[model samples]
Target: MLRTLLLGLVTLAASLVAPAAAAEPVAEPGAATTQNPISSSFSDTYADPAVLRGKDGWWYMYATSDPLHEAPSEFGLMHIARTRDFADWEYLGTVFDEADRPAWTTGSSFYWAPDIRYVDGRYVMYYTVTDTVAEPGPWNFAIGVVTAPTPAGPWTDSGGPVVAPRPTGNGDYFNTIDPALLAAPDGKRYLYFGGFHGGLWVTELDESGLRAVGSPTQVAIGDRYEGSFVVERDGWYYLTASSANCCAGPVTGYSVYAGRSKSPLGPFVDHEGVSLLDSRVGGTQVLAQNGNRWIGVGHHAIVSDVSGQDFIVYHAIDRNDAWLDAPGGVNERPTLIDRLDWIDGWPVARAGAGPSDTPQPAPTTSSSLGIVSDDPAAGEALRAVAGSWDAGTDDDGDAGAVGRLVPADGADDAAVRTEASAPREPRVEADVRVPTGGRVAVEVADSGPSGVSVTVDDAARTLTVEATLGPRTVSDTAPLPSRFDAGEWTSLAVEVRTGRATARLAESRLGDADAVVGVDLPNGLARPRPIQLTVSGGEAQVDNLTVVAAHQPVTERVAEPVPGDEVFAEEFDGDLDTGWSWLRPSSSVTVGEGVLRWPLESVDVVGAANTGPLLLRTPPEGDWMAETKLDLDLGSGTVRNYQQAGMIVRVDDDNLLRLGDVAIWGTRQVEFGKELDENGALRWGAHLGGPVAETMWLRIMHTIDPATGEHRYRSASSRDGVSWRWGATWTLPAHTEPSIGLYAGGGATPATVAAFDWFRLYEVR
Candidate 1:
């Protein structure tokens, strides 16, 4: 039966150091620290690690170690390691020795693939054991069960195998191995086990834990090997396993694969739509050969830390090593543990040097005596420490470096002022006092866009402002509103954004102040943001100040042809101006607006014999987005037909892209459809399409992209001339564009008319 284990909490301690004496020197900041590998320097031959968290809160890593010494005397000799922070691990002596088991059985104690679960406050271990030394039963190999109260155990076996080899004529009689227990949300228990040649099987375990409830059912089959570790997250169960040969050393290549299913049993398909059971079906390779460090990092288990961070504990053979044999005769294969960070729903191994164990420097305040002032008279040199302060190294190999600064006595509001005329760029340093939980705010003269950034310990904060001459300096403040406090004296830093400047500090008490550490003024311009543009009232506004920092030169440019491809171009030269006759005026498309305007009132329908089929055609067979602005202002009479204008593309005998007016009563309806002729009259056929609501001041856009073979239409309407609601998007299959023109068929009354204005089309490649 499956069980849930809750590990107990582990305690963490914070270390503190004492203040340095006078004249002691300190190393510069940014000094490098050395780190050690957590997994190296251990016994080899360990692979296929099954890591679990016990109730003691320590991580227990169990693996299939050397298989050669599996005799009853060497059973349970496989390795185990315990760790708390995942950095330093305590090597636990091997606790299991098969020879210690009762002499009632006839098998050797060779074990492989060990798994541990905490049930009923006891630790239960399951492993595959085979009797190569003696033959006492029909089965050569079987799963053995043992129980212990603690992970480091003197285990008591059940005296016999829990699962024996299947009898002849049974479907899965070949081999039984790789057993995994899964606890479902419904509180039921299930067992899954299988191997390379025989396939995987699942069975429900009865509450008593000794028997299967029913006959075992075949879950999956084929060459998919069975180091299956099943995990469920977000309502889906994921079965992760290793594929291909894993123990051939460097020459042996293996990868991890996974498949997900809504249920725990049956019908598992890979991302590529192939059943996992099929020999040809390949699953996703989550981790593969990545340099020499992680040549083969599969057949592993995941262990979650107290903070819920998951780490992958697996065995990897060094590329330099050829085999498990070593000078000590102990396999050199070592178990490696690395933090796995999730990105886009997939786990990625963090590849870098391990974290350092050295403590960081403390943030310094503004009033301590050790603070150094660049110039006592000029005052340009501020209480800024050089960037070379080292926290790890001690001066004279015994104590840290110190600086001293004296504050002017008496004056309640004492201030240190610096003249602008110092070195081309000047800086200041002064020790300022920081009360516990207190905040410091420094006021500087408004110089311009130039600014300064302050750093407390390792954290940095920036303030932008200008600087002025004579007493106008930038001050570094401590206990800033957002900074968290550390108990001891820490380093404070100030860096100038632009131009050289000097500074000084004034505080209430000089003795209680923290050391003012470093100040640096580097010459450079601030970063800029480019590509900022705004379009309004049919005009494009550009800003030159916005500049993009480019690592590589952007040389590719597009040239605009003088006369581009005109899919549908019309001048409306004829004078039939009534609805089909002449145009009526509206606010959107005004004849007085100087652009070609189409009114929104119904009138007589007029068409010349030659221009009856007024349509626009493009030379290329491609998708395009056409846009046009129109103003519809029908003051009196019924406004219809031309009130809503639309465009059409890919017109065929049966289907065409039609978007525009199909009005009923006084409301204007905007729609796109596949035009079909029922009995000579145009009719919209039902498909994956819909209609849009008509509005005034409309800019309609129709887009076509050949890559997707879909034509889309969008529009925006405005009432107060400011804000606009871009209408819904409609799409259709790409077809050839032959004719495009204004169609005003329905009108509110007999003599109403609609007008049109200017239009433009943009094609996307």
Candidate 2:
């Protein structure tokens, strides 16, 4: 299927450019400048976008576009767009065109989806062509091929159509478009294609790339339209496509849909058990429309920018005023772009609305930044150096006898504090140890009525403070001077003389001759503080309250579980235990929770589990139900596989019932069958691939009628002591039993540890 699809679209090897009008930059509002759409002025349409991140730090976006809006063109052109930031797009021109017109597609009027790839130093563009007027036949379209040296090309076609329309009886006879090429990790090339009027199909292509190596397989099918694109991430192949009505503006719309499969060819299924084509948002809707305020979104392409930011580009009708009308109505729709973020491996658009136009303080980018400190308590004060203070006027009054502190980024309500008095006790101390060649900037915010000078390392570094009645933020930058001496610690002390204040340290960017020293904030201050911090913006916070002392400790106890009498226990000496009678039910007991839990052992004994069938005075008749929970230890202290443990329902002795294990053969395989051996012991079989180790839980359910001689069985298992997979149902000859008991057998290797919680039998209506 891949080879056939690839052949159809790779015949043309020439590059052609569309004569598009030059785009003019529009003057946008301030908000628009920061949050403008990536493909702001380009006329774009989404088919299936083939995205590739080139080694040159550019993302190449190639997709099919309608050459002349509504008019039919001979072939589709592969449009290319490049970008670094998902928010900004750069048009890279068309990489494939039908100017030379390959013989097979010359008369065809439409090019559907074009997938592009850069392989072996050459560019390959795969595209599908549709003929509005069929060549006097039922099948009306074909997939063609084109190629180029660079993404932008000038000439060459593959001579003819690589993949033609299928035979009349084939399922994909209506159309063979929307081709998605995937270069599997194992060096194999696979192609997935199909669209509206047909289901998704897959086939392999030989290394030569001229034909399909195997029969094309129908992977998914439905009544609605479907387009396919394959992307591999983290070893998982994701098949994403658009569903429902696309391309008819807002009123006539569509939405994107996706699913995953381990193989290139798939039994693709959505969350619901429906084919991708028939899968719609609810009923008739296609792609959901999304934009600033508009809906009706469809035709999407997912690409990653130069900076490795993923983005989704799609066309949406901006119908804020006009109603979405069909049958040739005038509606202007434009292409929009939004950042795509991966949440739990799925694409989400425009996830976080980060800061757009808000100005931030310019980061320090110098080599030799230092700190100045003077402590009045240490008897050192009023010291000024030449390059320490800027000669700018303090318009906000945050300047002391020295220069004023400039608010770099329009800080609100900024003020300067100048307090001259006896030095107060240091509220907090920090050891300032700078990394070899880095500088640190410390920021402080004042939350008090007045401003006070803060001392660092007994050195009085004047911090101009701004105080607002509510909340005011003030900041200061301090550069660390020298490299740290190994095994040596430096201390920084902060003390306030008159007013109360709190400070915090932010971040530290790492570098060489430009390293940053971390500052630690002291504890017990009224404000939030940093304990040990790095240079980027690490600082300690202090409040008006004084430090308090420490106190003592206490102890407490919780709850526990109580054990009951052992109704049945096997010491594992290869012998059957006593006090256990597995019985067949007539009007009592049933498997409700998959596995039966002996209620006698549970806190809510009667409510959660059941206990009976001890001494059967009469043989119960009619249909019966039985189940048991088996706990097995596989390995890694967890259950692995094939650990059979459940109930033997309708047992004449032990040879006529069933058993079930949830986790079988590494995969969950449910089993239900009749016992073949006549040792009065039933031999039920489960074909799970491996051994069972750690604790695994299993449950078995059976319904049988003694008079009618009819019986049915079901089984299930769990790993975490909860949850079970009910196996396929089975039936057998009915039997009578005056006595029945839960039976558990150890595996061939006898799982080092095995146990059964409980068992029960009942009759269902």
Candidate 3:
């Protein structure tokens, strides 16, 4: 009751001083942030974002480090960039990109997605690294850490992984990547990680915060969720994770999903009351490709500015780059920033054509002194210190609002204090004036089973660290280093450690410790906790107080493994082939012995663009050689440009390579071309002369060049299934997968037929 009433006073005072009007938003603030992509580098391929605003007035961006085709250990450990305004940026190259990599970190590639926190004046980062992605059962990821004096390295890797996958690998734990750290209300640091196969999970970190202290709890298992960051606001923990395949160029299905929970390790459900354990469903859609060319955009970081407005920074693929289809352009995901809206208790990001091309509000820059001279700060509420305390003027000429203890009669022990919202590694200092017989103390209590109180007793001329956390209360005291002249103000501070407290009091700023004393409170007080200020004995006044926490960055996210692949073959028999399946809906297919007949309706191999009859199979290892005999039945109609059927190498509806018989501009010929987009616009390779007959043998060969490493595809036409005439050779995008099948599409007739005598696939020598 005392704590409640004492806190009420601070709340009331803060409320009175706060702004009364709704302030203008930063969005179109005549002086808003900058443009889309926020970057102009032709080589800016950023992903797996990690962001931090330093004291230096600049925001630094870090993400999954890419080696950019360089040899291992070539680029830095992680990609780094910086900007004063969110618009233009300067890429700072990589961090930890040393000569031989670090001996402590064992990985075959660049450090994957990483997140960083500023703890104890240094930046600590968590990242994933691994040796090889060969087997499923073997643990695939090892999350490591590195510390630096600044956000921009010279980072010294701890030389060890803090979170590693279970040695048993992909079973009870399908993944041990994408870690999100949080400092919860329980006064503990927690780490959240995992995805799809095993479900997302959470675990507690020890005080050092370099390793896990407990078993992990599974939180959610969506259809496919990864790359998540968790943020805490108003007692609720919000998790924003990416769902679906996020890397496929223009046709990617990646979107952001959100869910909230009362506890960090949650039985979290979405806005619909559905459990996170469910499959493929969104907790709540945070953002998606609502159209206009922004492709796959996921992996985000949420940053709250000093003015208290929240902004999200992430990576989104630009359609302009998506159209490149070769080299680094196809997947050149650039960083994006935009303001976030909080409606009710949740966050909503309204991005029209998100990964939006329009300019967004810049993060309201935080003042160096933390005072928002403009208007009331959203969360900078002045808290009332609880207990039986009265407001009064101090003997020292100070008059605004000073707390005075009101004891019961002459019994003393009365106090006034506020608490840190959660259990955090804390350090607090304050200037205080103690009456002749008084004591001013700061107490860190669990409020239930344990607590510690560090007091500066002027009457006793000593400093005491009294803690009651473990099984009993113990006192550790030290004589005053020098006279803290009574009647005048003195500076005192207390530092909270794992189950212990250290108090320092002196006449002036204690340059170095003359004496150090401490006592263990309780074993359970392992987490540095919220501390309270209390005054006992004579009147005591506390002012110019400051508090600091060491674990602020644990709330950031991230992970990736060598994606698993499905490889095998399919041979059509009397029954439907197992490996071969129709993609969505298109022409009808009837399978029989040595034959698969495609009856076209108003359909094409490329659903919206390329003209071809659709059929598909999983690409197995080694080179692929597909040969087939086709009898094209174009019906009695004038065949047009796309009127042809042959071999289809499809990546998706938007991209594919169709080569074979094609009617180009009123001419009938076996044309080799690539339908680069769903628009049916083909990058014509060449016209392989005119067609011989309706029945011809066709073969498409796909192989990876050992030298240049580019995928090579060749098409050949044959008569009598023996003598062959080869067509032009073509190259497909280096970063996509293709499934081979016989296809037919054209503007000639609504109805067409493609009959195959036999479709054979082989592993090329």
Prediction-by-prediction clash tally:
80, 82, 15
> What is the alpha-carbon lDDT of model 3 when measured against the actual structure?
0.55
> Which portions of model 1 miss their true places by more than 4 Å?
1-39, 65-76, 102-107, 132-139, 167-173, 208-211, 326-332, 341-765
User: How close to the true structure is residue 646 of candidate 2, measured as C-alpha lDDT?
Assistant: 41
- Per-candidate Cα lDDT values, in order, are 0.39, 0.37, 0.55
Which prediction has the highest lDDT against the true structure? 3
- Could you give candidate 2's per-residue lDDT for residues 77-132 as a string of tens digits? 55677654334567666644545556565444446566665433345666776642
lDDT score of residue 226 within candidate 3 = 72
Better of 2 and 3 by lDDT: 3
Q: Over the stretch 99-212, how does candidate 3's per-residue lDDT look in tens digits?
A: 647675544434667777644334678776543243243335556778776667777867566776565432433456666666543546677776544557788877666788
**Which candidate should be chosen as best, given TM-score against the real structure?**
3
TM-score of each: 0.40, 0.39, 0.49
Q: What lDDT tens digits, residue by residue, belong to model 1 across residues 1-765?
A: 000111221000000011122211132476221122344434434566766654333556666635322122232355677664444567675646555743434433445677676533356666655442233443355566677767767677777655666544653244566666664433344566665555667777555343356766665553444566666543456666655444434333344556667777756654544456543333433443332333434566655332223455555545456243322223234556544434334443331111112332111211112222211221223222211111121121111222222222331122222222122221222222222332222222213444333322212322222232334344433322222222222212222224432221111111011222223333342222111111111211000010111111112111211213445433344432332322232334334433454433433222111111223344234434454444433332133334334454434434444445444222233333334333354433211111122233443355444466555444334433344333333344445444333443334444434444433454433
> Model 3 residue 354 lDDT?
33
Global local distance difference test of model 1: 0.39
